[model samples]
Target: MVIPTFETTFAVPMTCEACIKDIEGSLKQLNGIQKISANLKEQLVSIEGTAAPSAIVDAIQSTGRDAILRGSGKSNSAAVCILESHAPHVENKVRGLARMVQVAPNLTIVDLSIRGLSPGTYHATVRETGDISEGPESAGAIWEAFKAKEGTACRGVFGTVEVSKGGVGTVFLDRPIQIWEMIGRSIVVARQEDGKFDKNDPDTLVGVIARSAGVWENDKTVCSCSGKTVWQERQDEVGRGML
Candidate 1:
């Protein structure tokens, strides 16, 4: 029998390695927790296993730390990344998250938030596919191309979020769009303040968040080859068998 697994990301406020150990200790008690990794810089926790999302979130919260479900590549899609400086001479300490909820078939609500950024107005937009092999940009590359026109990526611009002196802000877009439209795409937060996608200047880009999957797909699918699901069979057969 093959045991299936699921991956989920959580926004966790971890100040140090102790916090990560505490979270891991708490979650390790639960069955099906295959792996857990904490990204302190991004303040995010990534877990891969067969455990339930709620169970994992609850376990993390039990450690006396606040936790938010960034995205699970399931139900509602989510993407997360730490904002990086476009200018080599500058340093960025911002963290960004983008989540899409399917309220209706034709309409989706995009929720975005960023922390530890300079206090100011920022623009959010979706560019063309990016190259994710470049560290944080690896996932960010999902939506790196920006060809600003009237109704193209500009239309995907959710809006702006203002970071206060404390370096936190949020923006959202409640419009008509399908879940499939955003799956495997990327969301970008820019400090340019123009609300326009400028392909000419790379400095306009600030941070990026990449959604791993779409909500339209049933993330939890099973197969009946002696309890081996389709995904499991594919995994087993990959690079090891002749058809």
Candidate 2:
């Protein structure tokens, strides 16, 4: 749910400043996040720019709070509308991130993207946005083997690089690399050619959203013998069994 100025509102339930801080912190720390304007009083947080609402919900949900996407820009739309949620847009930002693992080895790209997209909506946007991937380049590797072409990184002269998943290319025509934060299993996403998710199918988004939060279908089992889900103990047992 990214839009003009990358602002997507969230309908959340909180009790104190700590609550707000938690939400803000969780949302802002994502890979692509740039700025977050969270309001606990309104029980809402307008996540500005290039990120996804799924990340917001996952963040709050992980913290034991319910998070629902309201809407983007101005409209008489429902606060928890899924219309835009299913529009054709950038696929999961972390889909092929494992391939780009060497891009920022030190930063450890998490499934968080709210920090790099706080300026405007990704819909119809044609310009690069943030310097979210300031990892090795900042550290100065100074690789002279083949220094990139014109605009291939966060400091490129042209626009930033845009990741496309399940759609067309939506490269920002003015910047360098468009950074996205992939949270734990929670993935930060954007639109491909238009920053709009698959609007024709809501089910698609649902599946990925759940997967993004480490949720599997139909109470799947991580522990075949005990019929329990995988977490720490199960993982430890698996490791021990192999030993």
Candidate 3:
């Protein structure tokens, strides 16, 4: 019987056409790779093959680049999408992705990536309400909320991520919050246009917002060799609403 091929995608940091060639050349060294397609503009690579996911990722990283396994079509414990702003927003394109990884019963790591934003100071945070469907507009009230609270920081402020001239910034937040608490929440990216944030100036508000990622069905079934699998342990913790 012939083994069926599987598909996997990697979120790579590719700067140019040369980077695309490097990825193709490195991955070709692996056996059983049937097809490969790379999009430099999006920094995504798709591969259909029988190779183990690890081997494929290693190959890409071996070329002196970073790679994050987005998922195979079947399922994966993450969500990703390009960030969008309403009309009349800045011209720069923004891409945002959130991923959850459970490191311990009480600890979950939330990885965030934002690319193609203006090179300057920006704040990334989670909000009480705001769905991906409404985009950043859903978080417009966040500014007023900050003013009402008499604080410099907005509500649900996670942390600050710096975007360089290359237009890339990353944030890693480790919290006891469960995966369920994260999903369906809004992630807002606020730009400090005048080098300072003023509640009085609506222009100092956010431009991009997205819903955080969530876990998939198969993510809970991969555990082995234990009384309670990792996923089960996390689910138990989630029920308690923290850690």
Candidate 4:
């Protein structure tokens, strides 16, 4: 099968040609990468490949530099969600993040990452409603539109991720769903009990999916709302364990 390829751009700290060479060299070792372009002036690296965005970020970080995904896919084809725990007394609620990009009409790539969770298998699914007033219970059931159209079980199931001993887990998945269908929905990640997810689990992380910028769609270096540069915002997100 031919894997679909899409372009993703990231903001990296590149000072000179050597920095670019180091990042390009590391990415070249990964499969599915067809092109790599680094701009020293813009501190941006654009990659065209079938590799997961998380993998690409890992590769760039391996070079001792942080990589911030600036944009992905075509115009209006990407979305993002920041998963947070609504459990009582949880000091730091942000637990995970999900990046979604529609690479094909029916294919959306979801790059999921989680930290500060117990070491075990967890299931992720898209809920029918974005409401989380009562946590996962209020998020409604797994999206049923795909089930009704395709005559299958709930299609909102995005499979599972195995959390490591260090409380970190990451998974890259592609589902036969469009990005538009997911906007304003809620994504929940929770530990399984008896091989099934329990919506009442207070520890289940939930977040509302919102549209994100596609390649070249966002170019501002400063945020108007926070009066912070892009790098500053990145630092804040990292400090909140959103990385």
Candidate 5:
């Protein structure tokens, strides 16, 4: 099967040609990368590849710089889910984030990142309903269409994310699913025990997938509602353990 490649842009801090060279050099070491372009004046790096966005960000950060995704894929093809735990005892409920981009008609790439969870394997799935009033239990079962189409025992399963001892996990997955079908659906991430997730676990996180900006779709650095710059918003997210 041929994996489709798409363009993704990131806002990086670049002051001179050396900065671009460092980032470009780092990205070249990753697999599935086809092309790399960096604009020093704009402080943006555009990459054409099948690599996960999270992986690309990590690579750039390795050079002692932060990389924020500016846009990805085509118009209306990107989605985001901010996973938050409903556990009352947890101070910071925002434990994870999932970014989805439809690179092809039937293929979507998901960048899943989780933190502040027990060190263990966790499974993620898209539930039939987005209703999280009662948490994951109220999210309904896995979408039936996935089972029927993929012939998998459990439907809507994206895959597993193995949390490290530091309470962090990251996974990049490409599934034969469309981004539009996942919109308004709830994505659940739960601790896996004996290879199965316990629905009753209070630490389970759930979030509804919502459409995000595509390439060149969002350009404003300051938010109108919060009156915060993009960097400020990022710092706030980091403070809440969303990084």
Candidate 6:
């Protein structure tokens, strides 16, 4: 059986009942048998079950919001999460919320509390992309890949994992995303222009996969899960609304 835990921040503003209800519906359909609890006031969630926490997370994430898993321990009372985005306006916000709901409609999701966090602030949206124990033999390679990152710091989390490399210029979680490591090795290859090469440039492989996964600038991406590399289903609405 899998006992999952997390501590994360949501970037979106969570100051109303509608917001709570909105996220709650996102996690209800994840592929697992489970018991779950969410604390909106403190921004947390807790679950005990036979499924991987990442499964729950990827489901919650389809709602266009980031769900990061922080730390886990047996017998801890509270699980925490953070909101990571804010809408451009009222109608756009509504549509964004709807997209989140549409991403994972059947997981057992609960929207905990929203405190004094700023609106539109992007934070670490981590979740385990690993597995609890390889499910039935019928599951595919994607499941196999996700199940591999469990228990480590990457459990139930994906995307831009923060690395605390030592330096005065680096005290934050803005490092390269850990998901890129899932498939193969990442090389620091750079595209050059002018008389010098720019090392601070974004690479290509990540862009290729992200675009393939429906997250290109013009794509309406849902959960940027570690394995969602191909745009399997098309979304009706696609636009670059906000970051």
Pairs clashing within candidate 5: none
Model 6, span 65-123: residue lDDT tens: 55534333222221222121222222321111101110111211222221122232211
Q: Which of candidates 1 and 3 reaches a greater lDDT?
A: 1
113-147 per-residue lDDT for model 5 (tens digits): 99888888898888889998877878887776444
Candidate 2 CA-lDDT value: 0.35
TM-score of each candidate structure, all chains considered together: 0.45, 0.32, 0.45, 0.93, 0.91, 0.27
RMSD of each: 13.8, 17.7, 15.1, 2.4, 2.6, 19.4
Candidate 6 residue 6 Cα shift, in angstroms, is 11
| Prediction-by-prediction clash tally | 2, 56, 1, 0, 0, 41
Regions more than 4 Å wrong, model 3? 1-82, 88-94, 132-134, 140-155, 192-243
* Clash count, predicted structure 3: 1
Best model number under TM-score: 4
Candidate 2, residues 120-174, lDDT tens digits: the string is 3222211222212321111121122135565554321222233234332223222
- In angstroms, give how far residue 190 of model 2 lies from its true place: 21
Superior candidate under TM-score, 3 versus 4: 4
Q: Which candidate is the best by lDDT?
A: 4
lDDT of each residue in 1-243, candidate 1, tens digit only: 232455667767789999999999999999879889888987778888756555676698799976656456455444433344344443432255555544455555555656656688887765444433342243332232354455555445567778889876765465455656665445566665333444323333444444444322322335544677544554553322201
User: lDDT of each model, Cα atoms only?
Assistant: 0.57, 0.35, 0.55, 0.87, 0.85, 0.28
**What is the lDDT for 173 in model 5?**
85
- Write down the lDDT that model 5 would get: 0.85
Cα deviation of 97, candidate 4, in Å: 0.7
TM-score, cand. 6: 0.27
**What is the C-alpha lDDT profile of model 3 across 28-76, one tens digit per residue?**
9999799999877766788886665556766997999866565653433
Global CA lDDT computed for model 4:
0.87
lDDT of 6 at 63: 62
Best-to-worst ranking by TM-score: 4, 5, 3, 1, 2, 6
